[model samples]
Target: MITGDALLLRPWREADAAELVRVQRGDAALRRWTGAAVDDEAAALAWIAGQARGWETGDRLGFAVVAADARNCAAEEGELLGHIALKDVLSGDGRAEVGYWTAARARGRGVAPRALTALTGWAFGRGLTRLELLHEMDNTASCRVALKSGYERAGVLPAAPPEFPLDGCLHACRPGA
Candidate 1:
C-alpha cells in the first residue's frame, strides 16, 4: 500500500464493486473520460477481478485510492476516493503508462496528484525508469495533475477513432525528475 498525506493507495477488492458501480454511474466526467460501463455490481466485480489478475501477471498494477482516515481499517472498508493504475507494463521494460480518475466528491482536494505522486515514487523505486500519462486534450484538470506530479508535456497523440475520437496530450516523467 502507498500512503499520501490524505490518501491511501491499495489493491482493489471485491467489496469495492458496489461503490465502483455507484461512482461510475453518478460521475459524468468519469464516464466521459474512461468510457467505462461498470453499471452493475457484477461488472464492477469483474473489473476488480481483472485488476487482481493483472497483478498476478505483472502486466498491470491497479490501486483503489481511498481516504487516509480509513488507514486502520481493512482495504475494502475505506471510503472509495478514486482509482489509479499503471498499465501496459512488460517484464524487463522500464516504461509504463499511468491513468487515474477521482471520485466526484474527492475533487479539489488534491487527491489525484497526491495519489499519482505516491504511485510514481513507488513505481520508480521498483526500477521503472519512465512513466507516461495521457489524457484527452480538453481535460485541463488531468493536465494540471500531470504537471503537478512532475510529468513534462511530451507531445500530442493523434486520435485513434472510435475509442479515442479526440487528440490527447502526452506527458512523460522519469525517476528523480
Candidate 2:
C-alpha cells in the first residue's frame, strides 16, 4: 500500500466490485476515457480479477485510490477516489505506461496528481527508469495532471480510430525529472 498526505493507494479487491460498477456506470467521462464497461456486478468482478492477474504476471500494477482518512476502515467502507496504474510494463527495459482516472466527486481535489505523484515515486524506487503517460488531446485535465506530476510533454501520438479517435499527447518522466 502507498500512503500519501490525503490519499491511500492499494491493490483492488473483489469487495470493491459493486462500488466500481456504480462509479463506472455513473461516470460517462470515465467510461469514454478509459473504455471501461462495468455495467454489472459480474463485469466489475471480472475487471478486478484482471487486475489481480496483472499483479501475478508483473506486466501491470493497478491500485484503488482511497481517502487517507479511511485508512483504518475496511475496503468497503473506504471512499473509492479513483484508479491508477502502471500498464504495459517492460521490466527488462525498465519502463512502463501510467494511466489513471478520478472519481467524479473527487475531481478538483488534486486526486489524480497526488496519486500519480506517489505512484511515480514508488515506480522509480522500484527501479523503473522511465514512465510514459498518454491521453487524448482533448483531455486537458489529464494533461494538467501529467504536467503537475512531473511528466514532461514528449510528443504527439497519431490517432488510432475506432478505439482512440483523436490525436493524443505523450508525456514522459524519469527519475528526478
Candidate 3:
C-alpha cells in the first residue's frame, strides 16, 4: 500500500514461497521473532497459503516488505526484505494489530518502522481507526518501530505469546490522534 525510497509493502504471492524459505533459513532472528517454520519448501508454501486464507477470511492482510525499486513488479516479486501484517482485523471495530519481521540484511535500515508507518496509514485509509503494536519488553527494536510509527504506549502484559516468553508492552495509534 505504501512505497518509499528504501522499501515498499505489498501483498504476498505464491511465487514468494521460495524466497520465504530462503530468508527464514538464513535469519535466526527473523525465525525467532516471526515463529515461521519456513526452513523447508513445504512449510514456506503452507505459510503463504495460510496468509492467503487469512486474507480471504478478513482476519488479516500480509504484506511483503521489499526494496522500493521493485515497486512496479507483482507483489512479492522483489528481494525479500521482510514482512508486515495487520492482524486481528475487525472491520466493524476499526482496529487491528500490527506485527512485522525484518530480514537480517534489512535490519538497521529503518525498514520495520517505515513499513509500520505505511501499514498504519494504509489500514486507516481502509477504514480502520486504530492500530496496535505489541512487542516483548526486551525487544527494544520493535518498541522503537512502534514509537517511530506514531504508536503510544498503551499498557503492558505480564506475559507474551509462546514464541516470545517474556513480558510485553502494548502500543496503540489512532487516526487524527
RMSD of 2: 1.7
The pairs that clash in candidate 1 are none
lDDT of residue 113 for candidate 2: 95
Per-residue accuracy of model 2 over 1-177 as CA lDDT, tens digit each: 887767889999999998898788878899889998899999999999999999999899999998877545344346899999999885689999999998898999999999999999999999999999999999999999999999999999999998999999999999999
Per-model lDDT: 0.90, 0.91, 0.82
TM-score of 1: 0.94
Number of clashes in every candidate structure?
0, 0, 0
Q: After superposition, how far is residue 67 of candidate 2 from its true place, in Å?
A: 0.5
Residue pairs whose backbone atoms clash in candidate 3: none
What's model 1's lDDT at 165? 94
Q: Name the best candidate (by lDDT).
A: 2
Tens digit of per-residue lDDT, candidate 1, span 1-177: 888677788999898898898888877888899888898999999999999999999999999998876555444356789999999888567899999999898999999999999999999999899999999999999999999999999999999989899999999999989
Instruction: For candidate 2, report its TM-score.
Output: 0.95
Model 3 C-alpha RMSD vs. true structure (Å) is 2.1
Q: Which model, 2 or 3, shows the larger lDDT?
A: 2
lDDT at residue 92 of model 2 (Cα atoms): 81
lDDT of 2 at 11: 94
